[model samples]
Target: MTDFENVMIALPAHGHPFTNLKERSIEIIDHHQERLQTIRDASHQLIEGTVTDYMRVLFSERAWGDMAESETYAHLEHLKESGELTRASNNGIFTYTNTD
Candidate 1:
């Protein structure tokens, strides 16, 4: 089987496969603060991108193991609701901005 198929097969059947999800989520966000800030400053509003795009950028340099994209999106939503981040959508495309 392909590596992608192997990874999919190895994933947990329920919930995220990683430990300390919330903490890791926060760390991921914090680690990408500079990039996020740059995007926000350049746009003068939200950082234009999908959750998947943001996820890729944020998680690119880190080893997150079997953590699913959906799990990361949910954590980002939680962060948005908690005022740790700001999110807005236009024409069905979402944008994210850092609060700090």
Candidate 2:
């Protein structure tokens, strides 16, 4: 079998692995689209808060549940890096806003 096929066979049956970094990043972004949009909407309304605050709001609204805080922050940072959002720090607290 080919090297690619061998690698695929080594992965667990229940495991999902991306072929490359770009693919993995795209999958993560797609999975969090709803949460991303919610943040975007809130940001557009001038709402700015830390990742934990956003998580609490999302959880309370039943829009997201039981996701890791770090993962949420990572996604937010990715959006910021992509220029879809803006991040600022005040007193060591990072807040986010929509770029548009």
Candidate 3:
């Protein structure tokens, strides 16, 4: 079963529960944050490059980056489409400049 399924299974059934609603909600949020961090760590390894090059690194270096290739690719595309990633140079390599 999935972690969510496990969480549900472990959740209190009725009046008596392991954690209150607010605590349970916080637990869920924390779980999601950890998962997001894993994905972020994987993507953080990717530097400026063409989409093809990025794919190579994604599979080679970030194979266990905690996200599916399709999902990661979609995110990369979204960044490009959203203007979060900019062209690094004349070669069409994409690089994200951290404004923060």
- Candidate 2 deviant stretches above 4 angstroms: 1-29, 60-67
lDDT tens per residue, model 2, 33-95: 877777666666556768877676556655454555676787789889999888999899899
State TM-scores per candidate: 0.43, 0.57, 0.31
Q: Can you write out model 3's per-residue Cα lDDT over 11-67, one digit (the tens) per residue?
A: 555545553455576776786556434434444555444445455544566463445
Scanning candidate 1 in windows of ten residues, the lowest lDDT window is: 1-10
Which predicted model would earn the best lDDT? 2
Q: Write the per-residue lDDT of candidate 1 for residues 1-100, one digit (tens) a residue.
A: 1223224223346656654445555666775565544344543333555566655644654744346455556656766787867788878766666776
Candidate 3 clashing pairs, residues 3+ apart or interchain: none
Give candidate 3 misplaced runs (Cα > 4 Å).
1-19, 46-100
**Total colliding residue pairs, candidate 2:** 0
Clashes, model 3:
0
Error of 3 at 93 (Å): 20
lDDT score of residue 61 within candidate 3: 68
- How many backbone clashes can be found in candidate 1? 0
